[model samples]
Target: MPQPVIYTHQLTRKFGDFVAVDAITFEVQPGEIFGFLGANGAGKTTAMRILCGLLSPTSGQANVAGFDVYRQNEEIKKQIGYMSQKFSLYENLTVRENIQFFGGIYGLSRQELKDKTNVLIDRLGLHNEANKLVGALPLGWKQKISFSVAILHRPKIVFLDEPTGGVDPITRRQFWDMIYEAAHDGITVFVTTHYMDEAEYCDRVSIMVDGAIAALDTPAGLKKQFNATNMDEVFLQLARGAKRGD
Candidate 1:
């Protein structure tokens, strides 16, 4: 078996006296699409923050891309990419400019940037709109552009925080196509979403409730385990007992 790309054991986080993440453990393999699901205040965000090196855990062991979460956060950051639902692009920057800026931040060489920028523009079908400000583009186009840029550096893992939110079903489908391509190219995708249909698309899912993982399995496995017909039913079977969302 391959070493897990993301691993955690008894990982916990707290806010003063309140436990925000409670002894969660999991492993993600390279190129896997890991779905992190939770209701509001279910500690999903807090756990992801710790794994992404944005925050420290109160206790437990974790390694992201072979770097210790407690000691090698800077290195962990280098091995990962992050994208949120908002797309995270500068509204005023032109499409081409945004691509160059983020690629440069990832330390792509000047020549590499020039080459990649052209490829990104071509792949996104943005040739006509490459010079337009990102804010001027439609929401769907912006979403695609944002995802393309997030992985432009080819990081080992990309943490997607509700990457498909607010877009139409068609656009969501298109966004997921990009996600599959990323995974196909060996990028481990860590994603969180409220869409049950989207949950069905995950390689495996871990659903959180009250700061701990309530269920973890392949969608089919989960359906059989819960005796539910779909992810929505499975999620509801667990989420109905959530105490944090109230």
Candidate 2:
């Protein structure tokens, strides 16, 4: 059987009287792309933060890459990579410079960094733009570079928070292809997105509403269970059910 890369049991987070995530339980298997779906303020980010060891859960347990999030945060950090919704590259730096900077921070040697940079630049088709300033690159290119930098350390799990936000449809598709390639190479991807079409690309998906998981299944399973033709309908129905306190 495949081992779980992420496991959470009744994981909850609270801020004062407001609960950000409420007793959420789930597991993501190795090499799977697990999509986390939710409306804004639906606790998706909060849950992801906890899983990434950026924040502590208020209660329950979370194990990432076989390390307890609360007790082995440092180990967890080393095993996971995170790409936020916002592109997080230095706009003033060139593409190669950005790669070098990130790789250095991850303790990579100069020779190793140079080799990886060359491979990445070629793989991402950024050979011609390697010397171009990141700020001058198109939004799609910047996003792609940011994603590449995030995984520079070759982490076991990569968490992406809306990694493909405002790009064109073609760019979005390309980004997903990159994600699939990463997963195929044995990296587990956990992501959050509002795009139903993108959600369908995931091997499994979990929908959050009002700080709890309202639905969890493969895309086909969700569609069948909700008797919906698509993920959007399933999401809408689940969201409405949550609002009605059902």
Candidate 3:
């Protein structure tokens, strides 16, 4: 098997006396859709931040896209894409301009930026709205644009923190289609979400209870192991015992 795109061994994080992430270990393969799920403050965000190089781990080891998280954070940033729960696009800029701006940040050359911009606009069926301000577009449009921009650089891994929230069911389904396409193109997707139905779409999922992973397995395996009918039941079975509520 190929080297895992993400590897963590006893990764942990702390805030003063409290342990936000407690020695979690896992691996995510290339083009895999890995779900990181948890309730309010089960340390999911902390663990993800450490993996994304936003926060350093207090102990243990983590390597993302072949770079050490503690020593090569800047390099990790270049090799991965991230989409936060809140939209990260510039509302004031036109759709085309936003794409250009982010693509530029990713170090795309003038011609490369232009080419990518054209391809994205055409692919997303946003030709008519390419020149429109992102603020004026609907939530679904903004979500799609945000996702497109996140992967515009073709990073090895993309971390999505609830990339689909508050949109209609149809829009959510469409958003997932984009995720599937990204994975098919060999982009590893590391996503965190509270949506159980969405969790079922992942290739593998890890559920964090408090500050540790309580379960990690494929959807069907988790269902069989927990004797649950769906992802929702499995999540409830584990998350119900969590000590933290943040």
Show pairs that collide, candidate 2: none
Off by over 4 Å in 3: none
Question: CA lDDT of each candidate?
Answer: 0.94, 0.91, 0.94
Better of 2 and 3 by TM-score: 3
Arrange candidates, best TM-score first: 3, 1, 2
**Comparing candidate 1 with candidate 2, which one achieves the higher lDDT?**
1
TM-score of each: 0.98, 0.96, 0.99
Could you give me the TM-score of model 2 versus the true structure?
0.96
Write out the backbone clash pairs for model 3: 40-246, 41-246
lDDT per residue for candidate 1 within 1-246, as digits (tens), equals 999999999999999999999999999999999999988889999999999998999999999999999999999988999999755899999999999999999889999999999999999888999999999998888889999999999999999999888888899999999999999999999999999999999999999999999999999999999999999999999999998763
Q: Per-residue alpha-carbon lDDT of model 3 for 216-236, expressed as tens digits?
A: 999999999999999999999
Q: After superposition, how far is residue 170 of candidate 1 from its true place, in Å?
A: 1.3
Stretches > 4 Å off in candidate 1? none
- Per-prediction tally of clashes: 0, 0, 2
Give residue 232's lDDT in candidate 2 (0 to 100): 93
